[model samples]
Target: MSGARYWRHQDQRYNMAGNECGVCGSRFFPGKTMCPNCHRRSVGKMKKFYFNGNGKIITYTIIHEGSLQYRNQVPYLLAIIELEEGDKVLGQIVDCEASDLAMGKKVEMVFRKLGEQGKSGTIQYGYKFILK
Candidate 1:
């Protein structure tokens, strides 16, 4: 990815930085301009929330087809994790085998290189999950 876009999302991708609605105290991953629960009433009442990255795998799948950037990494595991804060986030599952994955399995967040742009463009970093 381009350096501009990669850097722009570095915080959210690396730290699991999100926002909590002041009105309802509901937290969301990847941040949110407005709280889904409270709608516009919590527009400007959102507070920064950093997740501990402890969660459970709700569901998952192994992808044989991938994008150009991920062609070599086919059969990677993708999962939807439900955080302890009651928020769910979609991320890749790494450092483990597909046979080890199961519903409601515990997981922890990890920082990993998403990909790079040629030789000198940029190295993108993002969060992945692994069995805890």
Candidate 2:
């Protein structure tokens, strides 16, 4: 990602910041300018929401191979986590083995390094989940 774009999303990358529909109490991650449920009425009712980063694994996969940027992390765990607020998020699971995970297993977010842009470029950081 470009430097400007990365910085623009710092809040979301670092804080699990999202948005909620003031009209229906519905929430979304990565935030939304309008509520899908309330539509027109939600145009001006979206409010910033911060997730607590506590969730449960809905499903998961073990990566035997990864892309070039993440090849070193092959065999890592990735899962769709249902946050306590009800929004499901896809993130990497760290600090445990595959045998330790299962559907409905509780997990918590932790900040960690994602990767670096290049040898001397900016480093990327984001949230990863760990078994609670």
lDDT of 2: 0.86
Local accuracy by lDDT, each model: 0.87, 0.86
**Candidate 1 structure lDDT:** 0.87
Candidate 2 regions exceeding 4 Å error are 1-14
TM-score of each: 0.87, 0.84
* Candidate 1 colliding pairs, count: 0
Question: What tens digits encode model 1's per-residue C-alpha lDDT throughout 5-117?
Answer: 65766664347788899999999887899998899899899999888889999999999999897788998999999999869989899988999999999999888778887
What is the Cα-based lDDT of residue 102 in candidate 2? Answer: 97
Cα-based lDDT at residue 69, candidate 2: 69
Top candidate on TM-score is 1
Question: How far does residue 127 in candidate 1 sit from its true spot (Å)?
Answer: 1.0
